[model samples]
Target chain A: MTTPLLEVTDLKIHFFTDEGVVKAVDGVDLTIERGKTLCLVGESGCGKSVTSRAFMQIIRKPGKLVDGSMLYRFKKDDGTDEIIDLAKLDPKGKPIRQIRGQEIAMIFQEPMTSLSLMHTVGQQITELIRLHTGATKHEARNRAIEMLQRVGIPKPDRLIDEYPFRLSGGMRQRAMIAMALSCNPTMLIADEPTTALDVTTQAQILDLMLELQNDYGMALLFITHDLGVVAEIADDVAVMYLGKIVERSDADTIFNNPKHPYTQALLRSIPKIAMQRDELEPIKGMVPSPFRRPVNICQFQPRCNQRFEACSRVEPVSTLINENHSVRCLLYEDVAAVHQADTEAVAHG
Target chain B: MWQYILRRFTYMIFTVWIISLITFAVIQLPPGDYVSTMVSQMINSGMDELPPDFEQEVRAQYGLDQPIYVQYYKWMRNIIRDGEFGYSWIYRRDAKDIMVERLPASFAISAFSVLFIWMIALPIGIYSAVKQYSLADYTFTLIGFIGLAVPNFLFALILLFISYKYMDQAMIGLYSQKYETAPWSLAKFWDLVKHLWIPVVIIGTSGTAGLIRTMRANLLDELNKPYVDTARSKGLSETTLLWRYPVRHALNPFISTIGWILPSLIAGELIVSIVLNLPTSGPVIFNSLMDQDMYVAAGFILILSTLTVLGTFISDLMLALLDPRIRLS
Candidate 1:
C-alpha cells in the first residue's frame, strides 16, 4: 500500500541501571500511516511508553536507543516529500527539535500534572506555537485561542487565562490536547490521555480526540493499556508482550481473530457487558521481570498457555497469516499449514 | 485572601500572648531579682555592696517585690495602655529607645545577608542541580558542607582572623566611628556599604549554603517531573524547559521559606554581629541578659517573636499568590 507516515524498524531501547540492563523496548517494529491512529497495546512496563518516548527522542538518562531507524516520511512546502531518520538525529540537537513539536507533538498520561502549574494555559499553548513556528507573541496567543476553541473547551478566552489546576480533569486533558496541536503537528503521540479521568470524562476526551484527529489529519500514535479504548479509536493495533510485538494487524482482525496466545488471553480477559454474571478470567501468571527475561525465545513462552518445545528454545519469527495480519508465534510458524487448523479451532469453538 | 490574613492575624495575637507568657516564665526562671544582678556586677567591677537598704529600695521601685502573676499582669497592662515598652533597669533607658537605636543597623545587616544569600545561592544552586555530579556540583557541595559545618559565630571569627592576617581589613562594625553618629551622607553611605559586606558574609555563608542545597534539591525534583518531558516534546529548548517549568516550580519552596528566614537571619546575626563587634541588637541583648535587665530582654524577645509571626504570614500569602494551585485551594 502507500508509504506509511512513519516506519519504525527493529527499535531497541535499553536502560543501563545499577541493578541490571532493562531491555525496555527491544527489536519492535511499528508503522503509522498518515491520518491513521495506531495503538500500542500492552501491560505496563512492556515497552509501549518507552517506544513512544523513542519516537520523540525523549528517552531520559540511563536509557539509550541502542539500535533503531524511525524513518519519518513527510511532504515539504514544494509538494515534494522527504524522509528523515528521527532515530539518527541527536535528541536535543536542532534538527530533532525542529521536527519534534512542529511536526510531532505529544500528550501525556496525567492530565493534572502534564501542564506546568506556574504558567497559564494560554501561555503554555502560546509557548509551543512560538517555539516551533517562529510566530510573534501576539500571533502565537491568537493561535493558542484558536486551538483551545478547536479542542471544545468552553469560553476559550477565559480558560486561556486559567492555570491547569483551575480546570477539571477533562478540561485539563482538553487543554493538553490543545497545547499538543497548537503547532499543527503532523503526528500526535498520546500516552494514555484519558487513563486518569473518570468514565464519562474519558468518553468525552476520546470523542474530542477523534474529532480533532479527523480535523487535523494527524497520524496518531496512541499508547494505552485499555483494550476497550483501543477498540474505540485504533486504525491499526500492535499488541506488545514484554519488549516485543506479539501481534500486528488491522483493528478488526486483532479483535475478531487474535492470533498470538498472548493476544488471545488479553482479549478473553476484557469484561463484557452481557457477561456480567460470569466471573472475569485473568491471565494465569505474572510477567517476568526484565532481569529474568530469557534470551533467544518468545517473551511470552513462560506465561503462554499454548507453549510447546519450539516456543521455549527456538526464536519465533513473524509470519503473515493474511494481508495486513502478522503474528510472532510458533503456532503460526507455517501459516499455510496451520491456517486450516486455526479455522477448525475457531469454527469448533 | 483578606479574610484569611485577618484570621491569621487574630491567631497571631493569640500566639503572641502565649509567647509573652513563656517569655515571662523564662525571665522568672532564674532565682535573683535585677537588684542582685546589679549588686553582683558592682561587686565584680571592684565596688563594695551598695548601702544595706539599696537592694530593698531598687527592688521596691521596679516592683520586684510583687508576685509573678502580678508582674505579668502589670507588664501586659502597660503594653496595652499606650503601646509603651517598659523601662530598662540596666541602662535606666526606655525599652523602645534601645530597639529604635539598634533596629536599623540590625535590619540593614539582615537585609544585606538575605540579598547576598540569594545572589550567590541562586545561580550556583541552579548549576549544581542541572549539572549534578559534575566537578562544579561536587565543589559546591563540598563548600556547602564546610559552610554548614562552621558555626556562624565561629565562621565570623575565622573570617575576621583571615582578613586581619591577609587582607588587613578592619571589619569591626556596620560603620566607622564618624558614621556611627554622623547624619546620612554620601560618604557615610559608601562607608556603610564597605563595612556592610563583613556581616553579610559572616552571617550569610551558612544560609547561602543551606539555600543552595534547598534550591538544588527542589530543582532536581522538578527536573524529573513528567511535564519537563512534555515541555521538551513541545520543541522547547533545554534552557527554556529549565526556567519555564522546573525553575518556576522551584520558586514555591523559596517563597515559602521567606517566612522563617527573617527570624533565623536575625538570630544568625545576633551571634555574628557580636563576633564582628557590630553595633546591632546582639550586644544590647547580650548586655541586658548578663545584667538581668528583664524589661529590655523581654521587650526584644516580644519584638522578635512578633516579627517572626508577621514574616510567616507574609510568606504564606506570597506563596499563595505566586502559585495559583494554592491560591485557588
Candidate 2:
C-alpha cells in the first residue's frame, strides 16, 4: 500500500506548569491517508485540541513536545516521494514554517476570535497566500477572492473588504476556512470549527467542510466531542479519554461494536429522540484529573460497570481483535497477550 | 464620519461652556478677590492706611464690585464677542498675552516629554511582555515600580543634584542665563534643545513607567488571544506576527490616552515644573489661583478643559480608524 499522508507515532506533549507536569497528550498514535477524515473524538481537556495544535507546532509556552515522530510523506516537484519528520524540525525554523501553512494548515474553534477584527478579510487571506506562495499583490488578491467565493461567501468582492465583526458567526468561520485552504495544503487540522455556531449554521459548515475536503483531497484531522458529527463525517474514528485513545477503527465498527468500556459508555450516553430527559444515561464518573491519572490499571476502570479484577491489576495495552479494529482494555487481554507473544517471538527469531 | 465629527464638535463646545462657568465660579469662590490681595500687599509694604474708598475704586476698576452673575456675563461677553479672556490683574496685561508668552515653552516641553515617554515605553513594554519572566523583564519591572513610587518633584531634585555635583551642570530652568531673555533664534532654539533633556526625563519618567505597565499588561492579554495563534499558524515570523496582530490591538490603550495628553501639554507635571524651574503654564496657573487672579486662572483652566474635550474627540476618531469593531455611529 502507498504511504499515508501523515503518520504520528507515540506523540507526547506535556505542559510543565508551576504545579507538577500535565501530561496533556501522552503517547498518541494516529495515521491519516490522503483525502480521508480522521475524527478525534474527545471531551474537553482530553488533549484533542493540543494534539491538533502539535501538528502545526503552535503549542503555547510551558507546553513542550516531550517525545514523538510525525513522519509526513509528500511528493516533490519531480514527482518523487519525500519524507520529513516534523517532530525533529525546529518550530521557529524556516523548514517547519514552509510546511506549517503550506503543507498542514489549521482552523481554530472560536471563529469569532480566530480572525483578527482589526484586519479586513481580504488582507488576512492574502497575507497567508503571499507568505506561503510568494504571490504578487494582484495575484494574491485574485486568489483570496477566489478562495472566498469557493467557500460560498456571498458577494465575495464586497465581503472581502469587510472585517470579521461584520460577518455572522458562520460567515466568519467560512472566512477562516478560506484562509486555511488558500495555500492548497495537503492536510487540514480543524479544531471544533463549528462548535461556536448555531445548529443550522453548524450543519451548513460541516457540509461545506466535507465539500471542501472532497475538492482539495487533503487529509482532514477533524477534532470534536460531538459523536453525531463523527457519525456523519468521520471515515476513521479515534475515541480519546483522558489524553489516550481507548478505541480506534472505522466509523461503522466503532458505532456498531465498540470494544473499550469508555467507548461503550460514551456510545450509550448519547440521548436519542425516543428517550425521555430522565432516561439519558451519563457515564458513571467525571474524567479523572490529569495530574492524578490512574496508574497500573485501565484508565476507565473506575467508571466501567463491566470492569473485572484484572483491570485494576494490569494496565491494558492496545490489542488488535480483528483487521481495522483495536481497543485498549483488559476485556481483550487474552488476544493482546497472544499478539504480544507473537511479536516477541518474531523479534527473538 | 463627518457627521460624527460634527456631533462631537458640538458636544465639545457645550462641554467647554459648562467648564468655563464652573471655572469662573470656582475662581470667585474664595473669600477675597485680586483687589483685596493687592490691598493686603500694600499694607504689608508699610503703608499705614489707605483711603477707605480706595479699595472700592480698585474693585470697581476691575469690575469686581459688580454682582457675580453680572461679572460672569461681562467675562463671557468679552470672550465671545471680542475674543478677549479678560485682564490679568497681577501681570497688568491681557490674560491671553501671559498664556501666549508661556504656552509655547510649555507646549515644547510637554511635547518632548510625551515623545520621550512613548518612545521609551513602547519598545520596553513589548519586550517585557514578549519575554515575560525573563531577567530583563524582572529588571524593567523593578525599575518601573521605582519610577511609579518616586514623586516626580523628588526625582527632579535628585536629577538636579546629580547633574550639579557629578556633571558640573546647574540644569535648572529651560535655558542658560545667556538665553534667559534671548529672543527666538536658531542659537536660542539649540540652547533650549540642550537643556530639554533634563526636564523631559524628569517629567516623562513616571508617565513612561506607567505606560510601560499599561502596554505590558495590554500586550500580555493580546499575546494569548486566538488571533495571535491564527497569525502564527500563517507561517509569519514571530516578530511580524507580533507587530501585525497583537501589537496593533495592544495600542488601543495608547490611542485612548491621547485625550489626556493634550490637556497635559499645558498643565502636566506641575510640581516637576516648579522643581525644575521651567517656564510653563503650571506655575502661572498656580500663582494666579493663589492670588485669586480670576481671569488669568479661569482662562488657563478654560483652555485646558477645551483641549481635553478636543483631545477626546481626536482620540475617538483615531480609535475608530484603528479598530474596525468600534463604529463611529
Candidate 3:
C-alpha cells in the first residue's frame, strides 16, 4: 500500500446546542491515496457532508472539532517532503489560504448560492487566479477564458463576463468547476455537486469531473448520497452511518457482495431503470439521531433485519473480510461459519 | 429603472398631497380656529379688550368666514397657481418663503449628523461582530448600549453644561457667534460649524449607537451565509472575504433602513434644537405649535413630509443599484 495523500483519523465534530451536544461527525476515519477517487455515501445528517467541510476548517461557531486531525502530504518545489495538519492551521493566515485554492479546491452544492451574484462569472474565476497564483489581470483573464472553454462553456469570453443569474443552472455548475480547477489543485473535494442540477446536467458534470480527474490525476473525495453517482465515478467507496464508516470497499465489491446490512439496504434501495416503479423502497426508520453518544458495536442494530442479541450488546471492530475490503459488522467476523449456515439452509430449501 | 423612478415620483406627489391634507384638516377641525386663537390670546393677556366684533374682525381679516371646503380650495388654488403656501399669521411672512429660508440650516445639520454617524459606525460594527465575545467587543457593546440609553436632549444638556463651564457662556446649537440676524459669510460659517459640533455630535451620538448595532447584526448574519464560507474555503484572506463578499451583501439592509432612519434623525434634531436653543426648524416648529402659528407649522410639516419621502426614495435607489435582483417594479 502506498502512502495516502490524505489521512483523517478519529475525527469527532460536535455542536454544543441548548438541547445537547450533537455528534455531527463522530470517530470518522478516512483515507485517500494519490490519483484515486473515494466517495463517502450516506443520507442527510449522516456526517458525510460534515466530514467534507472538516477538510477546509470552515465549521461555524457553536460547532467545534473536539478530536481529530486531517494530514495532507505534498512534495515541495525544492523536492523536499512536506506534511501539514489541516486542523492546526490558523484559519485566517496565508499558509492555509495559499493551500486552499492552490493545493485543495472544493466545488459546493448550490451554484447559485455559492457563486457571487454581484460579480461576473469571468471576474470571479480571474480573481481567484490572481489571488493564489499571482497572475496579472490579463494573464488571469486568459487563464479564466481557457478554463471556461475547458469546461465546455459556449462563448467562454462572453460567459465569463456574464453574471451568475444570467446563466443556466448547468452553466453555473460548470463555472464553479472551472473556478475550482483553475488553481490546478492536488485534491478536489466536491460536496454533493449534482444534487441541485437536472439529470442531463448531472451527467455532464460527472463526465467533466472524471475527465478533469484523469487529466490532473488528483485525489477526489466525492461526497454524495446517490448510489448511482458512486457507481459512475468512485473507484473506492465508504458507507457512512450516523457519522461513522460502516463499510469500505471497492465499488464492485460493495455493489455485488455488500457485507454490512445497511450497505445491502442502500444497494437494494437504488431503483432499476428497467422496472417502472411508482415509489422507492426507502430504508425504514429515520437514522438514529446523534444527540446521544453512540455505544456498543452496531449503530445499525435498531434498523438491521439480521440483528441478534450480540449485535446490540457488543460493539464490532473493523474486520478485514478480504483484500481491499473491510466492514464494521458482527456478521463479517468468522465468515466461514456464517457461509456454511447459509449453504445448509439453501440445500434444505 | 426609468419607469420605476417615474412611478416613485408620482407616488411621492400623492403622498405629499395626503400629508398636506391631513395637516390642513387637523388645523381646521374643532380644536381652535387659527385666527380666533390669536385674537383670544391677545384679549386674555389684557393687552387690549375687544368688543364682540373681535371675532368678526378676525374672520374678515383672514377670509375665514367662507365655507370649509371653499377655504381649503382657495388654499390649494394659491399653492398650485403661485406656489404660495399662504402667509404665516405669527411670523408675518409668506409660509413658502419662510420654509425656503429655514431649510438650508436644517439640511446642513442633518447631513452632517448622517455623515458623522456612518464614519463612526461601519468600522466599529464590523470589528465588534468579528470579535464576537472578546473584551473589545464587550466594551464597545457596553458603550453602544449606554449611548442608546441616553436621551438626545440629555446628551445635548450635558454638552451645554460642559461648554458653559469651559467657555464661560452658553455654547448652544448650530448658530454662529454673530448669528443674530447676520448675513451669510465665511467667518460666520466657520463659527457655526464650531458651535454646530455640539448639536451635530449630540444628535448623531444616539443614532450612531443604533447604526452600529444594526450594522453589526446585519454583517453577522451575512458572515453565516454559505457564500461567505465558500469564499473562505477558496483560501481568500479574511479581509478579502469580508470586504469582497459579506460587506456588499450586508450593506443592502442598511441601505434600505436609511429611509426609516431619516425620519428618526429629523425627530432627533427637533429635540436637540429645543434643548440647545438653535434657530433650526425644530425650535421654529415647536414655537409655532406653542403659539398656534398655523401657517408656519403647516408649512414646516409639508417640508418635513417631502424630505421623508425623498429620503426613502433615494435609499431605495441605492439598494437597487447595489443589488441587481431588486427591480424597480
- The model with the greatest lDDT is 2
- List chain B TM-scores, each candidate: 0.92, 0.94, 0.91
| iRMSD (1 decimal) for each model | 0.9, 0.7, 1.2
> What tens-digit string does per-residue lDDT give for candidate 3 at A1-349?
8988889988998889889888888888888889899999998889888888888787777788889898989779997869999878776677888888888889999999988887778778888899988989999999999999999999998878888888889999999999999999999999999999999999999999999999988899999999999999899999999888989998999998898999999988899888668566667877766765457457888888899856655566677888689898878777565555455545755
> What are the TM-scores, per candidate, against the unseen true structure?
0.92, 0.95, 0.91
Model 1: colliding residue pairs: none
**Candidate 2 C-alpha error for residue A343, in Å:** 22
> Which is the better candidate, 2 or 3, if ranked by lDDT?
2
**Whole-model lDDT for model 2 versus the true structure?**
0.88
Rank ordering of all candidates by TM-score, starting from the highest: 2, 1, 3
The number of clashing residue pairs in model 3 is: 4
Docking class of 1: medium
DockQ of every predicted complex: 0.64, 0.74, 0.66
RMSD of each: 4.7, 3.4, 4.9
True contacts kept of each: 0.80, 0.83, 0.67
DockQ-wise, the better of 1 and 2 is: 2
Query: In candidate 1, what are the lDDT values of residues B1-329, reduced to their tens digit?
Result: 67766777898889888999999889878888788977888889998856888888888888988888999999989888977678997677899888888888888888888889899998899999999889999999899878878898887887788777888777788777878889999999999998888788877888888899999999999998988988889877788788889998987889877767877887788888777888798788878877788888888888888888777778878987888877776
